[model samples]
Target: MGCSACLWLLLSLGCVWGMGRRARETVLGTLGKATMLRIPPELQNLTLHCGEAMWKRDTEDPQRKLVLLKYSGGNYTNFMQGRNRFHKLDFSLEILNTSRQDRQLYEYVVSKASEEEVWQIQLEVYEPVSHPSIQILSRVLANGSCAVTLNCTTERGDNVSYNWASQDLSTSGLCSHNGSLLHLSYSLQDASIACACTASNPISSRVVTFNSSECNYEHGGGAGLRTEQLVLLVVVPIVTVVVIIGVFVVARLAMPRASPEQEHSSLAEDGTLHTIYSQVQRVESPKKDPTTVYAKVMMPMV
Candidate 1:
């Protein structure tokens, strides 16, 4: 009877050893396949939440371990449950032994959850900076025949809408939002105006203004009108006076002069006038010699 009992005990020991080896091989073999690795969704975030539970193991004893809990994303503490619950709990099923081979599996689970959480945080932060920027496209002149365009561009917002308003009474137009640009066109008169653009999202709002100067021709009339009138008044009269003076100077220099003879002829034609003219002509003519003389007495003495 003693021998039989010893034999049964040996057989049982062998069976238990075989089973443990098989379980280790199975787990390791699945890891080697790469495709068979299973990761729990809950363990994805490497960061732990407050009061989150984790399995902790004793550095000296491989079998003795306890649950460690986290109170926040970073804070961790021992899981101190009542004895009744702690004793019945199984650590083997919850905690896998940390080994060089388990690193990939652990990282894979944590990375997925962490990525999702990070994306959510980024989206929340982006909401406030998503407002659009307003740009002055063009403006009309004072003639009231021209139209001006204003553009509103969204910087980071999605599905953005725009509102535009002008302070000028003479201007009237509608605002249309297309993608990232807002367009507005209006007929301009001589008036000062202010334009504003409001960009809105479901969570936030922003506004921008394009204020026109009081002297801006596209808006309305102001002190600029008086300045223009003064320039025209001062310049036009000076130009007209200069042109009149130039015309008088040119006419005086270009007139023809009468000769002295023509003036005398126009006065009268009489015999005394003829005799005076004839005597003057005679005095002005070249004179001729009265007679010629010659002597030949020197040749007879030689």
Candidate 2:
């Protein structure tokens, strides 16, 4: 009987558990059927770092104050429909509704308010500032002549004005107006010149300076010729020396040394008949025709 009783108790608990789970699912499904209005995605992810509440004095009463609320983050729109008010006396957030949904929304709204009295809070907002960067496209060379173009660009700020000035007194072509760019085709007689650019507006001002070293210029006529001349001076002499050495090596290899026997034979063939005829005339003491003896000896050799 005890075991049967235990079995009945277990069955009853199982049924109760199943019914509770089914009821939970039904409630979730009903809530899911309701349309959910999402706050702006930017607002939902915003974090309010600080806020301020200024009380503007009414013109009629002077004693009654009108609330002027200013906040840093975009999440401030979330509290537009909520019935929450900032208490001046205590500087606290107070909710006017007691419903669960109202309470949840109010809690989220109040969390954005400042805990301190004076709301000088810093917030992460999409407020982009214009930061202008300047680059000098052309630069002065060592020869003291230059033509430069100025580039003015901003990451966020538009409608910028550019004013260019050289710190060197001798340089010319200063710009007086502001625009996206200022091109100055000027010449300077000084070395290491610097040009500054100023971008200004009614709210803020920014200045950037470009040094002569950072700018690049095209090689001009005289400069290009000088470079070529220098290269030739360095390279031509080296090539000429190489050619002379190569010629000397080839001549040494082709030159022939004369043997003593060949030199003697050449001398004999040139002067032997003349010497023999002169000797024969002197020995014979008569200048007879030497052609007879020459022809006899030459015929035997032939």
Candidate 3:
């Protein structure tokens, strides 16, 4: 029922102010989804012929009040064109493609005859959680146990939650969820034990695991990578090795082939060497037949 003061509607606060709040309801929506904010189900069926209806969004900043409509003749601003599609007469406000900016309080006031009713809606728009990444923040060895701390993070998530669980089934660690980050620390005496970090939101969840012994998990490195990334890392080296082997084989095959005649010649020259002796005589004057004679000898291959 709407508040009624008729002529005193402006002079008195009762007419402007809603008689009472039906319920403070929270509307949760995912980003880019459409959600409707309507009057309480109890008041939805009320067929109130309102003379004046005013809707104002409660805002903290000193900007234009997100006033959807404010007039006795049912007038709204051009601020809401395609976004707000529902009229308050039907007691429903439809918002499309809700975004982070759309998350706020919306107020609706409708007066029937002389009475006015108010509805306040709190909207929360969240994004689906993407894959979580876990990396070692710090590690210290104390006594026989190694104290390991890990950080988990994700993108496009709201009210994100994180849990650290161990494969040993005996080791449990405490974690804190601050915004989209999860911090966990564990004391492990055995390096063989493994731990997994799970990031979850109201919409989705993802898990990443790492060995407790080797907590050097980096953002995109280490065993914390997504399956495709790990696959690519493994395949790149194998492909490189294969390509090198292929190139070697191709080069060996492309080399010029030795002919049979060339092979025979190579074999014949492999161990054979020719040797010869030469004698020379030289005369300075025509009278002497020979002034000197020199002989040179060379050894042949055995």
lDDT per model, in order?
Answer: 0.40, 0.43, 0.63
What's model 1's overall lDDT? Answer: 0.40
User: Which TM-score value belongs to model 3?
Assistant: 0.50
Q: Which stretch of 10 consecutive residues in model 2 shows the poorest summed lDDT?
A: 22-31
Better of 1 and 3 by TM-score: 3
Sort by lDDT, top down from the best: 3, 2, 1
Candidate 2 on 182-209: residue-level lDDT in tens?
6664445445655666766533567766
When 2 and 3 are scored with lDDT, the better candidate is 3
| Residue pairs in collision within model 3 | 2-115, 2-116, 3-115, 3-116, 4-114, 4-115
- Candidate 1 Cα misplacement greater than 4 A, ranges: 1-127, 130-133, 139-143, 154-161, 165-183, 201-203, 213-302
Candidate 3: residue 216 Cα off by (Å): 11
RMSD, every candidate, angstroms? 23.7, 23.3, 8.7
In model 2, pairs of residues that clash are: 130-157, 161-178, 162-178, 162-179
**Top model by TM-score, which number?**
3
Cα error, candidate 1, residue 289 (Å): 65
